[model samples]
Target: MSVWLPTAPCTPRTCAGHTGPVRGRLPATALLLAGCSLVLAGVVCVPVVMLLGRAPRDRLIRWWAYGVVRAFGVRVRVTGRPQSPEGAAHTGTLVVANHVSWLDIPLVAAVLPGRMLAKSEIRRWPVVGPLAALGGTLFVERDRLRALPTTVRDIAGALRGGSRVVVFPEGSTWCGRGPGGRFRPAVFQAAIDTEAEVRPVRIAYRTARTDGQAAGAAAFVGDDPLAASLWRVVTAAGLTAEIGVLPPIPAGTLPGRRALARAAQTAVASDSANRSAESVHH
Candidate 1:
């Protein structure tokens, strides 16, 4: 089914009796801020990466992602480390993760050294799309049958050339207010086709707080004004995002893409449930 998105206004709804008054930033401000940071970072790092070419470019890009996430006021809390086989850390591998929020991209990039497969529409976005492309993100157009072949081939080639690719198997962001849902299965096809090891990463988000109770919750969907939701998150004390990297599933173990995707979805779903349980108890 097509994911449902909310169409709420980005206005700052007054939360009765809140301590300090917080004003939502203008949508353009948020976008401008994020865009400026990305451009600034790129100006400095892109050159060095260019000099180093394909080899050290991955490391530079990952570092740049980390900086962008930090500058955007998003905090990433990582859990189980990605299990890389001996000498696998430096080679190309496929990193699969559950999608939780718009924040997931920067959060994942903050820690993992990899590229990402994004929707082709991102390429035309005001600032982010272009920046993403410059940073090695692969844009996929699901509707265009012809584009899939090239997308897969390019991704496979990147893996064989020793570049890790981060793909969101869920294909769409879950409702930001709750736990993660199931995966869509298509993202894992590249891992299966390329014979690349698949590493499952799960992302989780909880309300930000100080003493107790949610300081604020930011759920971006439907018509929820993107800028307003972002302001609530940015101004919140701190939001915690949990990232769990499960052990890699060997290439030949799964019979086909469907099987591989199902296995990964199951693994991520199981881990996410367990993680949620652990969070509730603590």
Candidate 2:
């Protein structure tokens, strides 16, 4: 298999077993409708959003993302200040995070709205595909190794243009249960080339239950149908998504792409451990 198309051991049947405090059918249906409506509204406004200046567009995008997550009845808690605040004049930032669920995309965008690094297949997905393209997502042809360099070049160009680019370096979605896939070094090359700051963010899904365990209903892993995942999320009660923005790593400080990737992976992993310890203590 191509390195770009990494797979995770997490399967919906196995890892997606925690359906914490599910809501009644009527409420779940209402939440699902509201979430889908927000998504459609975003799709319809894309053209107008594209015309707006960077700052306003980013602000609107962040607002829309927050609404969508809330519409699904998911509570959001974000910690740590973003190295580059939205709408601020800054150098290119390569925002890297560990993959957990499909919700991770919007969850991160709510805090750091940027051009996303996504699999090329997402461009073909209904509703979302068109919205993603219109929002300036950077698609990767994960199946083709020969296209790797070209993808890196495109990413570097975006960074050079002073655009924040969000990428899930894990290359696949993990269950948020343990250590995820290693940070694939390819995307880090873009940061190295552009000397962009790498902001490592950690995304975790937890239930509001007294146990405070990871929310498995949010996991979108192997062979899970999109519809099933969506229903799972809306029906799951008290699901909270947490975003932990860690310290930024200057690419110039790292000698090579691999080192840069390792540094980011360590930052995310270390934060996860610290959070887990705190959870246990509490």
Candidate 3:
């Protein structure tokens, strides 16, 4: 298996069952419609957003992303500061996070709008494909080992051009109920090449009924259909997506990409552990 093609053990039967409070069919349907409408609206506005300057375009993208998540009745709570992308002296900011669900994409963009590092398959997705391309996503051919160097170079070029890039280094989506996949070090090479600032962000899903325990409803793990994941999110009541932005790791300060990847994984894992401990204490 290719290094970029890591797999997660989580599946719908094993991990995505929703134990949280659920909304009525009518309301859930309404939320589903609202979420789809927002996504369609974003796709339509892509051309217009492209015409704007960087700052305004980023602001618009952030707003659109937040709206999409909110339309699904999923609340977002962000902790810790995201490093600003406006550092003129440095390369772009590399935002790395743990993958939990399809919602993770917009959830991260809602706070830190940037070019996304995604699987090449997403570019072929129905409505999302065109939007991702227009929004400047960096797609990787994960199944092809030979494509790794080129992908890394593309990421490095984007960073050198000062584009903030969001990546899920786990390479696969986890259940968010336990330790996530390892942070693959390949993408970190881009940060190393461009001397970019690596922002380690941790994503978690929870519900009010669970007393802040991790929510499995949002996990889009192995072999999970997109429609199934979408339904789970819309039907889930009081689902909260939390973004924990840990301190930034200066790529220049790190000895190499492997060390940088480890440092980032440690920061994100430590934060997750701390949050879990707090939930237990309460």
Candidate 4:
């Protein structure tokens, strides 16, 4: 599943002739420029969040994410909004979404206010790693079976303390060209233990232009290198991502973690399919 990830712009072979290819290797430059702005935003906002409070921090983080997405030339069109918890505090809620590309993080963060659960390996990625860590992302070491219980407990404690967390139960990214992988039920345990509300968010990518395809630009599928993916995104014109924040499924209504995960996955999957079909019809 791993490839050398050559830094070449996506060509006709991969993206058809609809998108521009900004010379091979130049993708890194575009990404670096985008990264710089985001890093600066992160630097400034992290402090504000630390010195201020949750509401201020969440607002700034949302603005920061919106600015970054815009700076990168990606237009985001948001659909439905998330349901705020009824009587529960903000931390007593969990947000789950479908995974498509690395951009998904910023895209979701742009609207949803919370820390995300990411793989532990992401902590080592250049530029992004530090920002994520400073942003208070919780790293999950999924490969270790023994660590699951402790990690779940930690997350439960954080939730009970009023931490709204985002999780991608898919475990892997789908190309956005097909149905994504299923959501894992394990993370739902945190929501269950804390009696948190679970919200479903669906992200779908499409072309800005009526005649183009944005899959190559936005999807981070198997073996797609970070450099190449950036090239595709920067070069592609009229790329739009639509985020649909669906209703929250009351955790109390679900039997347990498995039931919660199933309901969420079904809701997300159904929404995603409908969204894609709508895009095609329009």
Q: What is the TM-score of each candidate against the true structure?
A: 0.73, 0.92, 0.92, 0.80
Candidate 3 Cα errors over 4 Å, as ranges = 85-88, 125-131, 272-282
The Cα local distance difference test for each model comes to: 0.61, 0.86, 0.86, 0.71
Q: Judge candidate 4 against the unseen true structure and give its global Cα lDDT, from 0 to 1.
A: 0.71
Q: How close is candidate 4 to the true structure, as a TM-score?
A: 0.80
User: How many pairs of residues collide in each model?
Assistant: 8, 0, 0, 3
User: For residues 1-282, what per-residue lDDT tens digits would candidate 1 score against the true structure?
Assistant: 232122222223432112433335664357448745684767555435656765466567666766665555555556665547666544468888766456677667666767888888888987666666776788888556567668778888887777789887665555533334555555556666667888877666554332423233433444456765665555543555566777788666988777887888777777343342221111
Error of 3 at 130 (Å): 4.2
Between candidates 2 and 4, which one is better according to TM-score? 2
What lDDT score goes with residue 14 in model 3? 86
Q: What 10-residue stretch in candidate 4 is worst by lDDT?
A: 1-10
Candidate 1, position 70, lDDT: 54
The true-structure Cα RMSD of candidate 1 reads 5.9
Q: Rank the candidates by TM-score, best first.
A: 3, 2, 4, 1
lDDT of 3 by residue, 1-282 (tens): 888878888888989888868999999999999999998898888888999999899889888998999999998887776655454465788999989998998888888898998889999999779877987988999999899999999999999999999999998889987678899999999999999899999888898776766798898989989998899999999888888877788899988999999999888877452342211101
Name model 2 segments beyond 4 Å from true. 85-89, 125-131, 210-212, 272-282
What are the root-mean-square deviations of the candidates from the true structure over C-alphas? Answer: 5.9, 3.5, 3.4, 5.8
